[model samples]
Target: MPLTRRSLMDAAAARFGWRRAYGDTTTVDELLTEQSEAAYTEAADHAALATAKNTDALAVQPGVLDTRGRILADVLSLEGVLAGARSRSLPSEVVKRLEDVVDHGHEVTVLLAAAAVRAAAAHTSSGN
Candidate 1:
């Protein structure tokens, strides 16, 4: 079986945006994958939704996309220039270590923030 661009758009619209007009939307992991084809598939789905409805209603707005793109560019630039170096200014292995650290930092920051807020809320509710 084969699909035209039109059918792809229709299917994406069903998977994304306002299908039930106020229900659970797909997670980022669900929308993207390591497979390049799946990446295109998700883009097609997202494109379909944009074409089919108001783009402003998107749960994950496009500004976040710009921010993430900048972060990715910074990461790649550092990796290309500084990763695995034998120099003193910035060793290549140091860059690799930083990459691993940054990767975990994202999750760690989230957990730290959540814990901070949780503790604050508990203290406030308990009234000392």
Candidate 2:
């Protein structure tokens, strides 16, 4: 049978072990919409925290490198998940959510790099 959105969502739910509470009457679209909102919010929160931490680290020393490393790892992990979702023919909405998460991760990396540069310049001028 051709893959309808419902079929793909059902398959994804099974494969990813996504389950609703017993007797829950939520439709798949509703569930996906909730999950998408949650994913976006969580990613934004994480990116904000990471950006703050990296900024603090830059102020203190060159430890921002370690934070950047972790950010890169997160970006890679998100990319992997996105690739898997695409490969499984998940819904465009789901894929888009994942892409947004990945984009947030990338933004954190960029912020970290800029902070590191500023920190390095400050340290150089201060002869620290």
Best by lDDT: 2
User: Mind giving the per-residue lDDT tens digits that candidate 2 earns over 12-127?
Assistant: 78888884332454564566676698799998987887677755434544566678989899899889989999999999998999999999999999998888888778767777
Please give each candidate's TM-score. 0.27, 0.53
All predictions: root-mean-square deviation over Cα?
16.6, 9.7
Which model scores highest in TM-score?
2
Model 1 C-alpha lDDT per residue in residues 1-128, reported as the tens digit of each score: 12355347657888876232223344333333324666787989877776766333232334344445566566565555444452445665666787676675455545544555565566567674
What is the TM-score (0 to 1) of candidate 1?
0.27
Worst 10 residues of 1 by lDDT: 18-27
Determine the backbone clash count of candidate 2.
0
